[model samples]
Target: MSIPKYNEIMPNILRYLNTNGEQKFRDLEQPLAIEFGLSDAEIIQEYDSGNGTVFLDRISWALSYLTNSGLTERPRRGVYKNTELAQAFLDKPTEEIQIFVKQQMALRTAKQKAEKAEEGQLDESSDLLMENNQTPQEMLNTAHESIRQSTYDQIIDTVLSKTATEFEGLVVKLMERMGYGGQVKNAGTVTQASNDGGIDGIIREDVLGLGKIHIQAKRYAKSNTVGREEVQKFVGALAVAQSNKGVFITTSSYSAGATAYAESLNGTTNLVLINGEQLAKYMYDYSLGMQTKQHIEIKEMDSDFWDGMQNDSKVG
Candidate 1:
């Protein structure tokens, strides 16, 4: 069975605390999963962050919602217990508990909107409330993802406007930034031909030049797609160069037939196809034409180290 939603899990968490007294945050997972008849797979499913299981994230969110709704208290770090209101809410219907938490969250969101508006800050249409009730870290992740996508769109537009030679130069610079021409000056060179058998550039795989990666870049419009015929021509170009590896980079996606054709030559000639979205991502990742505006660090409490210090303090 699928894991319970955050709101659905809230009442059970309060009830569990009411029965078990104060409990460490990590200690609540198995018992709660068992209580809800969650399958082993459900309990162990992971989120992209790799911080912990998805079920644990949901449970932590549920706990935070309850804490915000004035139904629970954390007397010490990572240890939560029932408040006076928690006992009464324990017996309440899940819907009722959810409504109370939603009301609390709505007020919080409204206050933030008012504060930002007072500062004359303009933002995208703000939601009155979020139903999933993301934690603060999750909110930051979502915001960063939005900003990255906007940057990618701008990168695609700028790249499509470049001249053929300029586009080839950009690809060479990107490849060099990806550690292609390490310790070797001028190891990446553009072919400088508009019709050089579908190849636009080449980069040495290492300083000694044991191998080379042939590049074919297409600065295509958003509506244009690189079809199988174009890929076949690139393959022919590779064969003419007597090269077994090639990179076909485009500011547009490949057709399904094109992708399949490239994959079919995996063993004979390794063909790597990078579409517009992925191209933008790699450019951004390698800092080709982007600068870091800010750096934010995400940190967690080191429980084992802190607990050891606490034990030593008691002994002292």
Candidate 2:
């Protein structure tokens, strides 16, 4: 049989956790597969992306959706247990699984709408789950993007709340987290110089401190915009520091002319301009000043298994 859709896996996941109390994610895959009478080939099936075994991915999403709906709680990473809602659902007759699933999905949708409303972004995209066109994978992707956008907004608000010096320190920390300086000892340094060059900080490219990347941070509000003159001064500071690369990060955006001027000198100097949105994205990506709230592991098909299966069939 084919691997079940993510929704179909939800009941099994809840039932397993409800019985087992608490379990690691990997421990549930084989038992659930056996319970479903899945064949060896089906058990090994993967998605097109080669991320992981398909059955496991479905189980992961089942757990994720359940958690989102407050039916389950992940006490720590890679662990899951039933909540009161899940236990109550399980306590009902087995025939009630379908009703429970629908109820949970409705709750999840309502919660999503409430979150979008709070973010002031309740729009058409937020209603995609209700639309008929999206596949299960598309639904999962949309949910993932929504979480990321929410994080991005939170990061922007957090940076906006910091002092100018504190913001500079955040940029330095982000650079260090991105592996700019090989060692944490002096991978990056913030220069609080009032009248020195326009540069705000410097990060080493390696542990030995061989090469350097210059940094300039602007803590401007979203309404303010960085202009051409700022970029020009940053370039001048690069010249003074004898550095070829510089990163100009701002909580605001850059004007078109500023971007054009920076692009005009792309070949002469490698300058990377990071605006508020991009800066927040990088911070989230590099895990700077952030913690792992939850994890959603996406699994895909394994082509090698099928290829080997075909080879074995031909040999037989």
Candidate 3:
């Protein structure tokens, strides 16, 4: 899952405060990260997209918004104590969280405008928030998707960097498990004699078929990162093989410049790169020429699935 930015997170913050009355916001800082599903990756997700962590920035914004409208209070700079106004909201039902956030934002905006008029200057906070309130839902949705994809890409990159030999193995197995097996060749050392210089092996697109997908399996190590020079070399290899695409795997990292170079060079060829960790995961997934007894059971909703449904529902 992608990370939620402050704007995406504010609504949830208000809900948690409204429902979990066991303590005030001041006492709840440490728990909000888990409560809101924020993690290292999510934090990166937010940061990459100019958002705040769920615990610190988003929660603070929610509190400030509530307090600005008299729904919460702060006894000190970092301490938030709920007020009678907030307590009164407890009985209003969960749906009220939205109303509370919206009202506070509007109220805060009005107050900021008034202050701006008196001071002969616009409040930057107010301006920062003004756009937050007016942003279209579609824009928010797109931003969320972008953040999620960015985070996923980062995850993929990290997995690639950390799992060199493993990730390449996974893609190889994934290709096979996905039905490229037997048809896909392996480099005795992961490449042909020259392996076309870029081609690691070739997978026959179909069994008993002449069509093939040329591959490049690189077990990239941290100290040995993939670079534009490697990409260019791979491109040259592709020409040698008379194929347009190849897979490059790394267990270390890619400079940003390397990625851009790969994406832009020779639009005709599709270059796929998998770092190390991803390879291991793929191997584990395909069980291709690999074995493991570790088992996972996915419960199903088939007939007789509700055998205990009535009793369980009643107990709840």
Which candidate leads in TM-score?
A: 1
Tens-digit lDDT track of model 1 for 187-242: 89989595677789999878788899999999889889999999999999999999
- Give the TM-scores of the predictions, in the order they appear: 0.81, 0.56, 0.41
Looking at model 3, residue 18 earns an lDDT score of 62
- Compose the digit string of candidate 2's lDDT tens values, residues 272-304: 999999998999888888899887776654646
| lDDT for 253 (candidate 1) | 96
Q: Which candidate number maximizes lDDT?
A: 1
Of 1 and 3, the candidate ahead on TM-score is: 1
**Model 2 C-alpha RMSD to native:** 14.6
lDDT score for candidate 1 against the true structure: 0.84
lDDT of 3 by residue, 1-316 (tens): 5434444544445456666643454456556666666666654444323443333545555666666667666553444555676666655654465566676677777887998889898665544453543333224445665754554455456555545455444555567676654544541223434324546566666545555666666655447777778777877877877877566665556667678888886668887766545554454445554555444343423435544444433321
Local distance difference test values of all predictions, in order: 0.84, 0.80, 0.57
